[model samples]
Target chain A: MLEFIDANCRLGRGPAPREGAPNTTEEILALMDRFQVRSAVVYHASAQYAEIMASNRRLKEETRGSDRFFMQWAVLPPVWDLFPDPEALLDEMKQNGVNSVRMFPAQFGHSMKRYAAGALLDTLAAHRVPVFLPFDQIGNWDALYELCETYPDVRFVLCSPGYRCLRWLVPIMDRCPNLYVETSNFLMHNGFRLFCANMGADRLVFGSGMPEASLAAAASQLLLSDISQTEKEQIAGGNILRLLSEVAL
Target chain B: MIGENVLRGEPFKGVFIFDIHAHIDATSDFELTDSSPDKVVRTLDALGIGGACVSSILSIHADCPLGNLHVKEACSKYPGRLYGYLTVSPYDPDTDLDGAFADPHFKGMKVHAAFHRTAINDPRYEPYWEYADKKRLPVLFHAWELADVRHIAELAPRYPDAKFIIGHGAMRTWEIKREVVKAVKHNGNIFADTTVSVAYDGAIEWAASQLGADRVCYGSDIPFYDCRHVVGKVATSRLSDADKEKILGENAKKILDLP
Candidate 1:
């Protein structure tokens, strides 16, 4: 059996709860056990719907004792101390064992351009900390391209690009070497095979998009893809592990 | 266990697997490297599925006539391994659904009223619905909302013979899913297809609990979503082995009247 480290998961009690999704740590652990997942990198749903910093704190508290959960913080620009300065934020993240960060530029109504978010982007790039961005929140392919191109050193993992993104995704991926794609909702037919053929297996990472998505569904894509076993291994967990290990913060 | 086979990346040994919703040929929207009949069959082979009912992307998005021809060719090439869903354009009055269904390989009909910018219960669709009713064929509709579910409920009794499979399970929202369940609960002919790209955890189990396993059939929306992905979801669901078997293939088999 292949071990899995779910790279994209949202953990928190959101306003509207769906049937069968785990919001509590115990439930999540049980689900992980059921799916044969070794661990997961999770950000709280409150980060998307409520106070960002408090949600990060809540996430830290929720996952504090478990080695199975890796914390990912939701961040914003440090304008008027809306968020901590980049250096201080990174320091706090290092202290809390938060290795990766997530940004919601479109949702938060902030520009991802250099003028608005340059300090934070520069700091993340300098530390080589992996950044997780939902593809829908990136606004458009051109915006994603600009964000990635402007900060080439910052590793951007695009989550849930969807099946229809290939027409736009390919060209951006061709230009942005720093861009990686999460495989949970990247559901195009023969997507894994085509992506590997075009971008190599290293650029793809396994993500369950759990709580709202099926863990088994995400795993089976790579498991049943017409690719070499080594390639499958890389996507199932290897690529994510490599990216996380490279996060100096 | 069925899930064990999926976890081991092996095909189901004893269970029959049939996909009720699938597509052939590439869509103009995205890149599908090998969506041809050969590739779809190879994918089914990888997952140990016996067959799939497919509609051409061309039929839904562009030229319906040319797309139906594509389906005919694919069904002919693969025989029992592939089944055709004859798609007709509501805008084009000259749709020869009767001629299209002359081929024995064409098992059902597919309608994307949502894509065609027409209501599923619109008068234009009535002729096709009547044709499907007369033949007692399974009509798969691209249903994604509460209105579509309501339309299916309204039309189901009138066309008592035609089996109505609500494509994507009316999956736009959880509330919509509830609406679909309520609307289709009393109708024997109306069924739900588990074809959404986002497969919500426990959604299938919940559906089976409410609608019964027989009312829910496995529809991968394949070539749009991988067959293995949806198959693994059903296999690993919290549903009973019998329920999983039914949803994965048994239910689809009964609906499509496949052997």
Candidate 2:
């Protein structure tokens, strides 16, 4: 059996009503076991809608003793006074052992453009921390294109981009090497093969969107793809592991 | 156990997979990784799908007659591996649709209201539905929203004999999918296909629970979507082994009347 390190996952209850039972850390661990996931990069589901600091603390508390889980913090606009400053935020993240950051600009009532996220992006870029954002909620591709072009240092991993959005993503990826796409909803037919052929497999990372999406459904795409086993291993966990390991903290 | 085997690329030691929805021929609008009949067959083989009910993209997106000819030829070439779904265009003038149905390769009908720019409950489709009911043929519709479910609700009881399979399981929103489950529950002839859905956690299991495993059929929406992902969705769903077997192939075989 192939060992998996799921790049995208959440713990705790989400803001919206979800089918099935409530999602607790235990439930997530059980699900990980069921799907043969050895480790996962996790964030609190409440972080998408709740106070970022409180949610981050909640995530820390829940995952305190677990070695199988890594934390990704939800960040807010610096103007909100949620934290001291971008530098302090990075310091706090480093102290908390957070290797990555996730931004829910739309849910948090802000734009992801340079005007709103400039300082945060600069800090993250300098720190070499990867940030996860949902492509659909980012308003438009042009904004992402501009961000990638402007910030050549920070690694941006767009999460849950639909297969239809490839036309826009392909050009952005071609133009920007720092940009990456998560594999949870990137369901184009032979998308992994074509992506690896055109852009290189290093630009793609494995993400299950587990507890909200099917782990089997998300991972099966790469497993059954016509790509080589080495490439599959990279997209499955290698690329994200490399990104996390390189985080300057 | 079968799900594990499917993930590991071992032979699926369960019911044979019958993809109820798939497309063939060249697609001009969007890129298809594999569009030819041979490629489609290879994909099915790779994913352990025993057979597929396929329609021509040309028929759905362009000319029905030309597409039907291609479909017939592909089915003829593959025989039992490929079953034809006669694509009916509301725009094109009727062209021996009944005669086309007489072909042994053609087993069902496929209609895309969104592609044809026609309403599902339009009077023109009445004759087609009538024919399907008479022949006990299944009709697959590309349903995506609540209104599509409403249209199915209106037409399904009217043509009770024809098995109406809702394509994509009305996969726009969770609320709409819930309505689809309810629609299938109330209407006996209405069925849902597990293809290219939103992959919401427990969506397949919820559908199976509400409508029973026999009402949900496996569909890959192949060439546009990956068959492995679709199969994994059903195989890993929180349903019983018997239910998973029924959804993966048994139900599709019964719906398409395949041996």
Candidate 2 docks at the CAPRI level of medium
lDDT of 1 by residue, B1-259 (tens): 6778877767777888889999998776667657888999998887788899999999998888889899999988988889989887688787777777788888898989878888887898888888889999999988887888889889999998999999988344887788788867878899998888567677778788878898888889888777778888888888999999999899888888886
Q: How does candidate 1 fare on TM-score? A: 0.97
Error of 1 at B210 (Å): 1.1
The best candidate by lDDT is 1
Fraction of true contacts reproduced, model 2? 0.44
Local accuracy by lDDT, each model: 0.85, 0.81
| Cα lDDT tens digits for candidate 1, A64-115 | 5789988899998888977899999999999988999999988988989899
lDDT over C-alpha atoms for residue A55 of model 2: 82
Which 10 successive residues of model 2 chain A have the least lDDT summed? A15-24
What does the lDDT read for residue B41 in candidate 2? 92
Model 1 regions more than 4 Å off: B92-97, B170-172
- Writing each residue's lDDT as its tens digit, candidate 2 over A164-249 gives 76768888988998998888888777788778888888878888887777777886666667778888888888899999888887
